[model samples]
Target chain A: MELFLLSNGKLSGEAELLGYAKRQLLAMIERRNITSAVFVPYAMIRGDYDQRAGELSQTLGIKVTSIHHAESPAEAIAQAECILVSGGNTWMLNQMLHENGLIVPIQRAVREREVPYVGWSAGCNVATPSIRTTNDMPVRNSVVLPALGLFPVQINPHYIDAHISGHMGETRDERLAEFCAVNPSESVVALREGSLLHVCGNDLRYFSAREQGFKVFRHGAETREYQDTSALRSLVPFTCH
Target chain B: MELFLLSNGKLSGEAELLGYAKRQLLAMIERRNITSAVFVPYAMIRGDYDQRAGELSQTLGIKVTSIHHAESPAEAIAQAECILVSGGNTWMLNQMLHENGLIVPIQRAVREREVPYVGWSAGCNVATPSIRTTNDMPVRNSVVLPALGLFPVQINPHYIDAHISGHMGETRDERLAEFCAVNPSESVVALREGSLLHVCGNDLRYFSAREQGFKVFRHGAETREYQDTSALRSLVPFTCH
Candidate 1:
């Protein structure tokens, strides 16, 4: 299985989508000799689906087609060479994935067919066991918590430590801590903006465009940041490469 | 129905819980001649329920007992004088309400029996028709979207326009706008910190201790801030007092 679970789609100053992971994405494309990709834009509630597909095509130099254009979304996933998921609303994305019966096909494509899966933000969220660790609001009335378990552990995308001045709501750290408290046995890998986790077969890698480390959150334990994938070995079968 | 849907329980630098709405709360207590409140602390994931109840007892000069100690949660709600909900995780709070069979009981208490309902943060989120507009993370496996419909329209508590300098995630406005886009017929009332919506019988009032106005978000319409409840008459059957 190959997955590029990015923390976010774009940085503040960068204009191109997924520009931070351009080097890794280019290497993956060349290694697999990929030319076309299937784009999943269900997470985008207010954006143009085909326009985003066009952006991804220009950024990655691939033939990108939105899955919505296909008559059957599941069939599109079944024959997909590469799967690209965009970031927007996690609830809507997961709901549409289930509603269109594309969950199992995407899971099989990534795990069995070794299809490269690239996702950022909400896309990164669905790669985990569940969407319980997502930062997006539950906008849809029909709530679906289960997601594509491409990655074994729960992940929190777009993780940040800074708080808006005088905002009385729970901070990101506090929200993650609450998740840890409720699910004591489970762990959440918080990926800050510009960071990502790359898993290929038995090898796992971690990268950050801003030279920042990722934090691991667990119940009854101190949340500590690490610069490598040493702490993730216990959660998944992948070894640091 | 008599309700106090508060944006938050406490403000920064304020030592007392629900201190920002003390004046209105006291008036409600006097109007109803209420002496005790049934505290629902299910939203509090880490804090001590009894300690919070004790703080409310001191702050309101009324006996505040956590419903966790009751033999039957539904029975406790049926016999309660006032229902007080704390600020915490909305997903867990709504789930617990459904699990303990308190949804209908609380609804009957607030609607039929005219029990004074006071909720802040997660509590306020659950007062709406659904918890879709909440600003908290969904940290539970079983996702429950239905909430106590004391308030007809959806509300976003702890709403803020300011953003952390470099966070790439959607802002509060964007998230609410996405909600409006998905639910075009519905509107979201964005309540800032230290703000609240009070409904007494057939009269509706809006208050913000910080003197800030609340914003109304709807699809294909301008998101505007309002200092009064004149704009909400169309959404609910209440007249501005």
Candidate 2:
């Protein structure tokens, strides 16, 4: 079983996210011996789902079936060996899941059955317990969608430390600290560009590109900093029960 | 007492948004004798708040007496004539409230004391019963911040009816309808640019600047389309205790 959470798609196929490990991600899928993939994208409503699926198939060198409508989701996953969820409007996607009751079945497929699953941005948010750490706001209460909760900790994909270079004081750091102070039990993993929090079966490691490292704020402990994503993952082991 | 939830500043000046009625906003404020104002901008950093409030003061020609932190928001409202909230990020601002314990007090002020409260973006989301209608994504559990329930419905501010001029089937319309189908009791208000849902002491109205309007939805009922906020005041009286 394998699952990947990406903050965003690599503009040209290069995953430029910190705390995200591309090599690790590839290895996980290889271990599952799964090539057939399903890409669920509700964010891009401008074009047909087939266009996106074809592009993913071309890029990943694997067959990717697109699930645009809810009815197609179950069938798409049935034949697919792995699931890859891309980023878009998390709220809209969650709403779709709740209304359609896909959250539970997906969890079952990924956890109990060990079917490989991957997600980025909104997808990453769904891997956690709640949809609280997402950057998207809840525009309508109609989207009361709970998360899949595969991981106990929250993932901050596209975890940008500074929006721009040489920013000001009370940075995102300050706000993150404030978050930790309020909810000490909940953990926040900040993933920068080209980074990933890798969890292979039972091996969980945090990987990053270059010197970019993400921060981890676990409950009750002093806010600890990491030099790489693997270092953060070392703290938490993903034991599929 | 009065509060004007602004999409931008200069409702009567340069900071005014694209689809709202400037004269109506000014009249609402004038009727309340709002000489002083407090700018609440928890979504943005302190620097952004400072700049936004400066613009509002320059345009309105009113003294921005205090810039209250959400942690101690009531203190800012105590002696103020009006409370104006600016737009930026709702999740971060909501996080600030959770850290500071401001949601309950702000709601209390608006409900009991009649503290005229205005919200834009994040502030607007909190004003409703929940922040379920925002465009932001809480990618993780850490992003779970409590929201204020000033209004019984959710506000999808900066509602993008269409991302591009000619796209697919109505994205915003369909998504909103989907939201209403799930949540039959709560209403969803889509305030396009330059549009607002203005609430004064016992009077709630829809004010529009250009042609843009709001779409309201309730449970098990046909969704209603409103072109002007003013008409809503009479349709739904401020009778909620």
Candidate 3:
């Protein structure tokens, strides 16, 4: 099993989508001899699905087709050699994944077939056990908190420590702390804007475009930052870089 | 119904909680002859309920007690003269309101008894028909998007235009826009920090501790900013000040 879960699609000052980790992504795609992949763009609330597919195709030098074009989204997931999920609204994305009946197929494909999976932002959120740590608003009337549990531990994508001055809303850290407080047993991997977690079989690796480390949050404990994935080895299935 | 929906409890440089609107709150308490109020502190994830109640008691110069002390929360709402909700997590607050059978009782109190309602942040979100516009994370396992429906329209409290540099996550404006895009018929009132919307019967007024206006968002229409509540008259039942 292989996975590339990114914090976001594009970082500030980067011209291309997934520009920060283009080399890593390209290496994975070429190593597998992948020619084409299915793109899940349900999380994209404001972007064009086909255009995003085209961008990935250009960046990865492989054919990337949106799942919307397929007659059966589940069948598309089952038949795909690789899966690429885009970042956008988590609520809408998760709802769509459930509504279209692709959760099981995607899970089966990734878990059993070992199809390579790539996701960022909302895309990365659905890979977790639940959407509890997502930062997006619940825009829909009906909401389902449970998501695809591809990744065992919860991950808060696009995580940041900065705050907007004069805004009294809870900071990102405060929100994650509340999550930890409520789900004391669960841990959250707080990924910054340019960070990505790469999982291969039983091994996991962490990368940051800005040369910084990610932070791990737990209940009743001070949040500790890490420059490598060594700390996550004991928590989940992964080896320290 | 008399209501004071605050964007947040406290703002920068403010010495006391709800200090920005202390005079307005005092006026309402005195005018309504509200001797004591029931404080709903379910949204408060980390703070003590008694401490919050005590703070309000000091600020409003009236007897304020946390509702958790009551054997039946719904019974407490039925007997209360006023209701005060704190700011913390909106999902937990709305979920508790439904699970503890306090929604209808509180609605009856606010609608029939005309009990003055005061809420900040998550409190403000629950007053709306749904919690879709809330900015808090849905940390709980079971979530109910439908709220008390006291306020006819949805409100996004603690709204800010400021953005942390290099953060790629959706901005406050962008999130609201996505909400509008999904729920085309629905509208969102973005309240800035230290701002509030006061409802007195059919008349509604806007107040800002920092002397700032609020932004109104609707699908297909221009996102407009207004200094007063006059613009909200046509959207919902509120006599603009």
Q: Report the Cα RMSD per candidate.
A: 0.9, 8.8, 0.9
For every prediction, compared with the true complex, DockQ reads: 0.88, 0.17, 0.91
Q: On a 0 to 1 TM-score scale, where does candidate 2 land against the true structure? A: 0.58
- Model 3 Cα lDDT, one tens digit per residue, A70-96: 999999999999999999999999999
Alpha carbon lDDT of residue B181, candidate 1? Answer: 91
Q: What share of the true interface contacts does each candidate keep?
A: 0.85, 0.27, 0.90
Q: What tens-digit string does per-residue lDDT give for candidate 1 at A57-92?
A: 999999999999999889999999999999999999
Tens digits of lDDT, candidate 2, B1-241? 2445544332333334322444664665677677777777776632456667766676566676446543456666555566766665566677666666666666666677776787766667767666666654442344553477666556776665443221211245665665565555556677765666766676565665656567765556676667755434433556322
Model 2, docking class: incorrect
State chain A's TM-score for model 1.
0.99
Ranking by lDDT: 1, 3, 2
Better of 2 and 3 by TM-score: 3
Ranking by DockQ: 3, 1, 2
Report iRMS values in order.
0.7, 9.1, 0.7
Number of clashing residue pairs, candidate 2: 56
For candidate 2, the per-residue lDDT at A162 reads 42
The runs of at least 3 residues in candidate 1 whose Cα sits more than 4 Å from the true structure, single-residue gaps closed, are none
Q: Please report, in order, the local distance difference test score of every candidate based on alpha carbons.
A: 0.94, 0.60, 0.92
* 10 residues in a row with least lDDT, candidate 2 chain B: B162-171
